[model samples]
Target chain A: MNKIFETPLYAYSRSPDQESEVAVRHKIVIVGAGPIGLAAAIDLAQNDIPVVVLDDNDKVSSGSRAICFAKRPLEILDRLGCGDAMVDKGVEWDLGKVFFKEREIYQFNFLAETGSKRPAFINLQQYYFEEYLVARVRELQAEGKAIEIRGGNKVSAIGVHDDHVVLEIDTSEGPYNIETDWLIACDGANSTTRQMMGMDFGGRVFEDHFLVADVIMEADFPTERWFWFDPPFNRGQSALLHKQPDNVWRIDFQLGWDIDREEELKPENIDKHLRAMLGAEVEYELEWSSIYTFQCRRMEQFHKGRVIFAGDAAHQVSPFGARGANSGIQDTDNLIWKLKLVLEGSAPESLLDSYDYERIHGADENIVNSTRSTDFITPNSEMSRVLRDAVLDLAEEHDFARPLVNSGRLSVPCTYDDSPLNTADGLDGPEISRPGSTCPDAPFGDGFLLNELGDKFVLLTIDADAPELVEEDGIAVTRLEISAKDDTSGAIRRRYLGNEPTAVYLIRPDQHVAARRPNYNENLMRAAIRRATGKE
Target chain B: MSDLILTTNIDHADDFYAALLGAHEGLSKADSDALNARLVLILANHIGDNDILSKAIDAAKSSG
Candidate 1:
């Protein structure tokens, strides 16, 4: 890492900034140095686009906030060059045990089938996650990539122009204005940019507040998601326990709405709850404790003129599903490539609307899942409680009802089923990576299918010669011709080739399937490419 | 997803109805109310379906 990023926190000395000089312009400026902003910055930087990131705070988040990192976000992070480090640092687990009162109902496994690179989910502190991302950015920057992280610089105001966005940034010395071709607002849930624009952020709030406590203790608890509903220790409420790195345990107790926040967070009160949950003799030191009332809300559109919103700035949801930071990272994964293409003028500006459409749909999916988990855990009415208890009781005996056991329905990547960018799936290929879905990873000759694909449009032809294809816009062609023995051994034919003699799949810059043909067809590929880039 | 599915999901609707009405026949107002609450819970547990339970709640809350 460069000296500029060697220290994660601290106010930076001012460079010869263009405060009064003619407003300095950049290709793109990202607000907030959280996971989403840093992820987007890395995405753009990988595309060789110059990016500047502004953060109000120095260093990463304080505690193990947003501990659960889902596989989808891990995959996205892997592309940006920090996935392995996170996995190494995180505690990986997929099993979850749901308890009703004293007896255990059932245990569920997420992504039980294996051979995938990343696990279903990993528990890591938010600060470490951001630290890895910032480190990745530094690695890219050291490689002569154009990226800058200005810690302690906050966006004072945002002004949208017809073709550019002007942002006034506040620093210790003074404030300066910088214009960008586009501004990505990843300033998180309390986004100043969204408030400045006065956008309508609408959704429901889960009134039940939750006490989050991170305890640094070595306990003989299994590395699995353990959730208790109406347990004797918690009376009529719910509790969750998760394992993070550094032998720290992330504990959550659902306290219903209408309680004094101060009283709830008092050390004595926290000590009582901890003693009840972990027994009296468990030795531990309090790492962190806080209370939060979550919400499942989102903006109507992610993009407004040259300014765009990503991550928590655009949407929010309860912490139940581990969707908050993971979805935000996915938001950048969906936005950066499209923004890059639009910036390079290879794609029309209308291409960015697909980001809003696909991502709003994605956000809505998270909100719906979070809302469901919230309701299931905390019943809204007496009837609701009765109904939930019935299901839980039934789950103990009947296998059919076990599926209804909702313990924060784990996060997964949302497929863009109705994306305008997708051509209908008519081939016999696997549904896992159909059109408008994340590109499935399979062992190619030596590397993975995803590794072969670049950060640009590709024409993937399995077991065939390179097509005499017309490369549209800046789309690059990487012709892959795998041998038959390796094909079956790698599960490549099973996942992608199917029974087709020659299969062709058109992929977009964001690694989403745009279209696929049973056989090579240049005209079909060209049309799909045009539609994908908003050129049609 | 739930409609007031009236296609006789239960095996013996007539028998269940007879018992339901008979259970409330000779009870005072408070006892009848308690019986109704307990009955609702029992049947709800037996049903074991949120969609159906929610529909039943809605139907009971609404006046014909």
Candidate 2:
């Protein structure tokens, strides 16, 4: 990292003070037209907020950076109405296979759970996702909404004042000045905006680097994730084959720490590795090959004054568990609503500060989990190598150890504790009963589901005889209607209510149960609503 | 996403302190409480859950 970037005062993506009359003002200005930035633009614009999306790129890039989109991000995409299109184009996968020395050791089928039309995971190209989102942004703009997209516009200077931010944008025609109420930096890991804000991105870069290549293959392979540990083809190397949309495959090879960088990116080098791994006389054409170094780091703060950070600009984790892009999209999901609230005058500007509060914590947690996974996948020390080997060996005898063999570091759905929104009932014990945990998806009624009830406030009443609570305009309460006599969705009743005197379990939009009351607690319920909406 | 609410290891109180008030950086209880109040009001607006949102506001003010 550059020393200038290390300083909190550094500003690299500064807007240039250029001369042009194409000046426009918006309620918000978003830099970098990536998926997260585009999502924010579409969301705010659809909500009738004036937004300008600036991107230096003229066209969508080829290949997928983030191949797998988890359910949470999918929900956010659904909110923007862009998810359905992506869902149609993407391939859904629920099963993954792990191999040890050419023998399949264990397999995980995510569809083991009931009550979901959609699969647990989807594989889609990042470019296609962006392409679809950009179209949606244009669609919103055509309806006379306030959305201005400035392509090939390089921001030269960013002048932040008391109330608004002024940007010096250099467009294809000339330099122009654009001002906005708020500025969001969705620039990548080497973020110019994050550097400009002078926030320190803290973490270590691993010594080893991996080669990633996407290629078209002639041979047919199982529609499953194939991973190898300690392969003999390339001594001390691990390889993976992931099925893509077409007959193409995304392959990743862990080249030891000391491989020649220039030589490794060559097609012949990739061909040699592929030939050895495949062991078949198959014709393949390499599409893209690059060396990616893993760095696990997060910014100290996600916000500084009116300028805020999101996505890679905030944190960059290794590609382990497919967390990099997934987490960035999550940052968008968390920030967009808060920014919308602040912009709409529903909450104080201090509410904007929580953007940093929650997302920085989220990024920090991702870095920790991702770093641990990276360590397991590519153990650096001798002790780690031996330990990893031992665990894989244990999988041969123990079914419990199978996940370890598969490098299955489950992605944690983040929950917040002590959040300003947490209620007393939310603070229950046993760690697993923590207030801000990720709400689990389970079967509800016939063909109905639990996670499907998200995207809105859900008040689940367990007490059938409890007095009627007035239905608020925005909040929706569903009586689980479960008692000793009820056995429909039998396991769900046993799981959440659990013989406790739980009456009403209030779940938030993010699917987390906010407060569980044994009976109707009007005061607590009202207070919880106020906290969730900033109406108090 | 699965419908099972998977709780993390951290508790709500500690998460609030670390995430919102910068408790890990040595924020005073009074300041944390004040932040807690401000955040409760703000987050109430963000949450779609009315009952919980209202409860959050009460908890914030009463904490102060």
Best by lDDT: 1
Of candidate 2 chain A, the 10-residue stretch with the lowest lDDT total is A2-11
lDDT of 1 by residue, A317-428 (tens): 9888899999898888888888877777778899898999999999998997887778779876554565568668766755545656677778888889879899878588
Interface RMSD of each: 13.6, 17.9
Model 2 lDDT per residue over A357-465, tens place: 7677777778766766676678665545654665565555455445444353445557776666567664232344345555554455454345355455666665434
Q: lDDT of candidate 2?
A: 0.67
TM-score of B chain for each model?
Answer: 0.62, 0.41
What overall lDDT goes with each candidate model? 0.81, 0.67
The CAPRI quality class of candidate 1 comes to incorrect
The value of fnat for model 1 is: 0.00
